[model samples]
Target: MRVLKRLVFWMFGFATLILVTPVEALEKHPLNYVDPFIGTDGTGHVFPGAVVPFGMVAPGPDMEDRGWSYSSGYQYQGRSILGFSNTHISGAGIGELGDVLLQPSSGTKWTRKTVNFRSSFDKVTEKASPGYYAVTLKDHGVRVELTAGQRVAIQRYRFDRSGKVQVLLDLQHGILFGDGPRVLKSEVKTDAVRGEISGTVWSKNWVEREASFIVRFSRPISNVITLPARPGDRAPRLILEFDLRQSRALEARIALSTVDVAGARANLAAFGQPRFDVVVQSARSQWSTLLQRIEIEGSDREKRIFYSALYRTLIHPSDIADVDGRVRGPTGQVIKAETGHYYSTLSLWDTFRGVHPLFTLIVPERVDGMIQTMLEHHRAQGYLPLWTAWGRETWTMIGNPALPVIADAVAKGFQGFDKAEALAAMIATSTDPRPNAPAWAQRDWRAYEEFGYLPYDLNEGEAVSKTLEYGIGDDAVARVARHLGKHEIGKRFEVRAAGYRHLFDPSTQTMRARNKAGGWRTPFDPLVPTSPMNNPGDYTEANAWQYTATPALHDVDGFRALVGGSSGLSRWLDRFFSLPSLGDNKHLGQEALIGQYAHGNEPSHHIAWLYAYSDTPERGYEMIERIARTFYSDRPDGIIGNDDCGQMSAWYVFANLGFYPVEAASGRFTLGRPLVSKAKLHLANGTVLLVERLDMKDVELNGRVISEPTIDYKSIMVGGRLSFPHFTAQVPKAN
Candidate 1:
């Protein structure tokens, strides 16, 4: 009987340990729940490739053709792989940088036709994680696996049969905006004995810059071929052939550098050849460290969406500096990085709204690095960047969005940046009408300086929208100036920050486009979108009705007064939400509508939070809850629009955390219902702020109940528990 009892006790103990071990491991990590493919389909335009957090080499497959679907190089519906490129742009509207495209082929002849060499891939067999991607090519019967180091991309090809296998390095196959081939300088050669190829391709698109690469293979090549450039083609194809067909596996390493091929070679040497599994494991470990910063408790699906969103947010603003800290500047000069890292691909217009603010909370280290990059751009190009990519500025969007990034970082107590240089850059861009500035900003510069608003009579499309955006930019500059002790400059900018109010017509109760004579434009319709093809329309991408809530960001009180009062504001919001305009809002760029609130774009991100200040906290909670639930999901088509350099994803991150950065660089977050049961924010100051959604009636911090609808940056940085109990409209009076 004693022996039998002992056996039963041991068996029960083993069973209990088995059940608890997995749960403990899962509780410690949320990275495994990340779905990299969540936004790859539909209009998400995110790349499902192998990259560490802010990696330089985003190695992925490019489709056979160019279009909106191929913006990120690879679309989920694309069936063929022309070649695997070492560098790519993520979540961008324009397709560029399929540089150093390497493809494995079995034949000797180089064919121009994509069907001759491009392999058909099975989407079902494709597997992707935060740091790894693997797909099987049906034509060559080769399995391709991709993983990356900080500066190098490693591709491993497993072939079914080996004999005269060749790797194609196609420099001519790249897309800029559409199906038209991009122009490039001719300089490419492959060395047979060394198994290496080095060259540079200078492509002109939205930004004209050069990309140099060094590709090294593990095996010796039997032959090398360089095809001649076709008609009107400046770039030609280069191929390397391996005679060892009996070998089952082959490896290739592509190191990209914006400076020079030598820089690329240095990058390859920094990450020495490691086994495929070791490289993949290193990538996974790096991503795991970054993703574990925010620990969340929620359903499996919610965790998947949350972690995936977090993953996408970190993919952009890539580190362009080589291992030796050398990078090509916007002026075609080789500039040594001052901060040990220089990042490129600044999608400032969209990211300044939410992504950079979230970076201030979790990845403060990168925030400082990004700010330094902007300052470096100013030093090299004489102006701050609005839409920078590959060390070149593109005239893609309007206003000075980089201002908010700097202001938000400074407001959040982040250090390690040159504040004086940042201020100088902001002032220079605000005053100077540089020819390279976005056309709208340049065309309306005079009106903006004299009339304090972009006038519609100038025939500048998007006059009102640019006015609102410029106002936000001015407000950011004012906040930063005040922080730097420039009281007079701060005061001047503060007055200028009210530029949006000039367009607000009291009679219409909507911000309208005003002519040079300071009168609202006639025949105005609030439901019409501005001209998308070119500027000169009243708005940029939205209608007057959709943009009506924008001024609420800086002047919530004044905005309420403009609408009449709290009651009037509430009634206006009710009509806006219940109105039927959303059903007919087929604007190409606008998406994810709840009535006129376009959740898909950045302008409407703050509208749902307005209810928090409208004397109806309950309405705010309900609207935010609905927005969170209805607009987001954990699938391939999860995103309703372009991730827009992770701005859309950042909105989800903050909204799920129970607060939102309604105003750009305002240093204030308005309250909303948090989706997670509990979340612990690990701030840069080595403090933890716990957020809990308890089933009670009061909102409390650390133990005491608080009545304020808004929280400042200092409160969160100091660290404590922000508990939101059951919300109701009958709560304590507003503070």
Candidate 2:
């Protein structure tokens, strides 16, 4: 009787807790499950969207008229968001694209090319955690929900009344970088629509047009509305409108089908579930699993920031076209998955720098898969991509961080491809003699591989950027060769690392832009980071003062010399920042105070870490903690910028991890602040890298290695649970 009573009491208490408690996964990974609309309303160009673990499709809408900008994909400047699609580009550098565009329009209600359609914020319901988004368009009175599986975008819409609900499907959507739409064929039927769309964005080669739809209306109504009242002509779109009464449940169990509408409807029948609660529930579970990968036990605030950061990182490299691995290729024919995998949208150059590294630790399985994708690029294209979007290399952002990413992945034991082939590709790419440039220009890649620097005379037009980039390449090369056991190669690259000295004007005590002839570029002003004419000489899109000092790494001896000494350098930095904004968003001055440091771009990514290289790494930690806490918030406009895919989040993760990746290739992590007091990173392997007794000051106060800890961070091993600690003791400010 006593046992029964106790059991009953326990069960009753459990039931009560369950009844009273909110959803467990609601905020498990706080930001992960965020309603992406917070900052996306009208502020930042962010999309209130959804995505799965490294999936290639981010199906959203085309509402805003901001003209295909990356972040503000569906500019809310319209009355009604047209429809949901299979793919979308997020926070892209240049512009946006609404791919596989589908809409529920009236008989002939096509969104005017210029009509503004900004819906109230209350209409959109975005489940940002795992991968789900549902919105009720106030203008249309339609309830839309979206979810993502491994490689699919599932959409369901409930219409109050099915009154000629034309489901408009447009093939020609994306930004269309350079290649125009090359849709081979499109097949649209009563219950389905399938098509193939492909064209070049940055390069000429490769075709992709794979789309599928499985739509079921409350009652089949009107007909398919396509472009022009003509046949035997290509129609850019098709609209499916239906007719039904109010209070009718219109369930759209749509599935992405690369094959055909038949396959699509079949797929829908197979997986296009109709339950809204079940769909959201499933999505929550998916996000829960992904976000929990790098679980952190911190304050609610820290968890919020951490999960949000993680959420942002998963926004891009979206699932572009086709589901079930069926795609249209260079030839105007539908082809099955060649490698048993379909992929698209790669921001590797910017992302591989920090984003890919983050994945290395969190999503180890995807690491090898991503590498394989890059390797495929090497096989298809002549070289590994610098920046690829929509199945083509964009060649934006310098530095082939692919080398570092693959090296780091392999080092961390992610082996799903042929390392030898990967190595060969890296070596082949590294040995390339010349970067694409004008005839008279000194080749960067080749000179980097051969002469250790872009020879001064060779760099006639854009000299400074050449020198700096070479310095970066040298760092990447050194790290690669050093780890790959190419000792001689590493040594050679290390020699090239000193090329920054070519710009080092000893007499001026600054690393000014120097001419190839070993002379300071005359009529020079260190503050003007750009070229001599000052219009656009390509000092890597930034002026002189910001690029001159290499503070991010432990270039103690180098920076010391440039400023004539450590104190002098500190004093220079002090004066450098004490001034007002220099009238440039790139410099981060007017918005965020700093010397020449530009939070708007990538050049300054290492600037905060410079303090780590300084005599006071703790100062770096202080600065990082302050910047992260100040700049990054928990709102729609939370992040200061595009999160640069993951660079921003990378900074936070490393800062929270109590370390920062200061270099592209170097395994060395400059110490920084710990966002969490106690954080453990569960690694694939069993061992752990314990970061205990860590305080913001611990990195500086105990500068000396206490454990014979010559951290041979030639490359990091992402093995297991990493603990980010908070120390009780605080280091005093430098006297």
Among all candidates shown, the one with the greatest TM-score: 1
In candidate 2, position 690 carries an lDDT of 42
TM-score of each prediction: 0.92, 0.78
Per-residue lDDT of 1-735 in model 2, one digit per residue for the tens? 654474456446544543576776434534344445533533234666666655555667666423423344554344456567665565554454455655553223543342322344363353444567777766555667776654445566666564445455555444443343434455544433222222221112122344555444445545554555224223356555556445334444435544556555444455544465555555555555556556566766566667767766766554333544554332224545434454455766456556766676655556665677667766655456566555555455455556666666655555688776776777665665445522533334654444444544555445566566546545555665666678897787667667676666656555565434555567766565453233545365566656666433324456656675656656555545454445654222123336666554555666766654345545556666666666666665565555555566666676676665555444445555565665555444433344444433223222443221113242235332233335322433211
Off by over 4 Å in 1: 1-28, 107-115, 438-444, 534-536, 582-587, 727-735
452-519 in candidate 1: lDDT tens per residue?
88787875578888788877778778888999999898988888888777887776667898888987
The lDDT leader among the candidates is 1
Worst 10 residues of 1 by lDDT: 726-735
